[model samples]
Target: MGNISGAIVMTNLIQVGIDIGGTKMLTIAYQHSKIQARSQISTGKDFTAADAQTEIERFIHTLAAPPDGIGIAIPGLVDRAGVVIACDVLPNLVGWQPAIAFSSICPVKVVNDAQAALMKVVSELKPQTVAAVVMVGTGIGAAIYANGMVLSGANGWAGELGSIPIEGKTLDAQASGAAILAQLGIDANQSNALVGANDITALQSIERAGTSLGMGLAILINLLNPETIVLAGGTLQWRGYLAAAMQSTQRYSLPDLWASCRLEVSQHGGDLVGLGAASIAI
Candidate 1:
């Protein structure tokens, strides 16, 4: 396996990270920031919590030895106790507790995927910096990091921006990859259709989705006034989405607030969720 030394500081040995997404799952074993093993698999539409556990277990079997700890990042609402509270992207994951299911494997921690993404960048932030990571993937989700700490709030549900109401429908219903794909009469796995789309209807649908996402960003800027907002996720691959989002964010946000906040795309090109989860395991 490929190794990247000193990318992340670790105090433990043989840590494992599993990132479960709507269409795929990625698992990696790390030995002090160096990869020891890795695997990627598709989690089809009907994939359930049990299926996830089975996949995790199977991947662990490939490692040279048992891991000291495991962390799972789910694209949904996870409680403080590392239990899946709710997950709209992977509906069957709701209520799934990986810690309990994998007690025999090692110590396990569960985290919201977007929050886990935030963790990947947390160590690099300047103290007292207000930042947020908004992930626009199968569905939209965000996590806030303020004043040198992640703003998890009372149930680890503070950043459910996707659920925010907008014109009677949730933001996710209007701006997520799934939403855009649905409008184009395609399936979640067919997101490639959005790339280089030249048709007027397809382009318009993408613009609307991007505008909706921008509105959501405006909400974060107007209320939190964060200094930096990092945008991440698979949907960002769409050609015109970012442009539309930038335009709408400027249009909807207060001029002073917008001027102070700098928007960034993640520079960590690897499996960020997996890396973040692995960091938590350490």
Candidate 2:
């Protein structure tokens, strides 16, 4: 596969991509040619930074030998050098550095979860189109890509659209999965009771959730001008729910910016971080 820069060839190496989110951990094993397979595990509250690292090492023991490069996608701030500054997804990694720790084990590259997702979009958009990614999972995130180059602002927090501060609260606080659950009168601990609990009720959940997403997308469209914005998350699986908000928000943004842009739910799968992590591992 090509490098994040579009033409840089990677070394002949087998790579592993690991995504550590607040609710789950996903791993993907891949060669430059294609993904071998993917795996996922629940990230109960007990899963921590060190535990996540141990999980990766054990996974490596089964695939490639030690000393192989690894890429990590975590929630929170990612510096230009791929160092995680802060993250709430894994409490064990709070202020715990990856370069100093994981690098000691093997050459490790770190990335913000959203940027990692965008990398997969960039890889998938190869040869012609540009891409933008909006991931609305437990929280919301977005990143822009043009010619395989990612646009990260000066503070290294570029893809963060969740904290735009809407009506005395951020979008994440008001409309995240947790927030959606809160609106449904569910407890914080029971937030994900619906991921696989799909039914007619889940369909209603989708439309209700889409209303919040539509409001958020309005802000996104006005700020970032791109050819296409792809939405990725379990929330988008209810296709009608996602499409509703996307179209609803269209009436609120600038004509020029909104005219050329298209809102789409990414079929690229949630393994994006794992896949893109492999792409940039070397």
Candidate 3:
């Protein structure tokens, strides 16, 4: 956990953060910016919105103190009304009212997962710096932070980079983990094992996916002119993939923008979304 702000020094307040992903859900309990307890559950085919809420409540029960506030990071586009508008990765969550569902539990704030990740990145940067976060996992998603806040545009669809059209197909179709695995004839269930092995075909496919991801990021850089770009997600774990992505980003981005913007992987690791969501409560 990062350093807690001075505002938290005068009181004993517990905050809960939940990160809802397509394959798993993680809930963390924090007191004075330190982790008190954490829990994880599989978001399998049987998972539902109610399951997520129950898991969150269960994690809260493990904490030493009751939570005063809660924050949830959800995958997909979240409307201003706190409704999950579109979540192709977790179809069951579409139109769900996460905040309302958890309202009785505590004060709650919900954010798009990618936007939450961006918030985590911004928290570590110098104030007022423009930055962007691009996560290439099961799918590709991005969020931009400009001035002092995240740029969630009208309809909350501002950062749906995965859905960006490229060569008559969506960016997700060309660069996501599923897409890469399909291109390499690897079963979705075998992705982790195959990624660990020194398989030539898998490496090549990852490189190709990296190139596609870089192209998409280059467009974002040209438009946003951010000072930094943080790359996260499981797909970036492959060897040589980050180098490929950087090279392609340079190739496609305007020279000045590419030169001025620093591109690096996320520092928060797996705790990114949880931490970001917790920031809302803090």
Best by TM-score: 1
Indicate the worst ten consecutive residues by lDDT in candidate 3.
Answer: 1-10
Model 1 has an lDDT value of 0.83
**Tens digit per residue, CA lDDT, model 2, 101-147:** 67666778888788877776665566355567777776777777765
lDDT for 248 in candidate 1 is: 93
TM-score of 1: 0.92
For residues 1-282, what per-residue lDDT tens digits would candidate 3 score against the true structure?
Answer: 122222222124787878888677888876766777888887844577888877877777777767888878887888777788877778888778867877776888887888778766776777667788887777788888777766777676678899998888898998887688768776655765766887777778888888888899999989989899998876787666788888999999999999899999888877888877776764
Which sections of candidate 3 miss by over 4 Å? 1-12, 44-46, 185-189
Candidate 2 has an lDDT of 0.69
Which 10 successive residues of model 2 have the least lDDT summed?
1-10
Decide which is better by lDDT, 2 or 3.
3
Cα deviation at 33, candidate 3, in Å, is 1.8
Off by over 4 Å in 1: 1-8, 188-191, 194-197
- Model 2: colliding residue pairs: none
Candidate 3 residue pairs in clash (backbone atoms < 3 Å):
none
Which ranges in model 2 have alpha carbons more than 4 Å from their true place?
1-4, 7-11, 126-130, 146-148, 187-206, 238-240
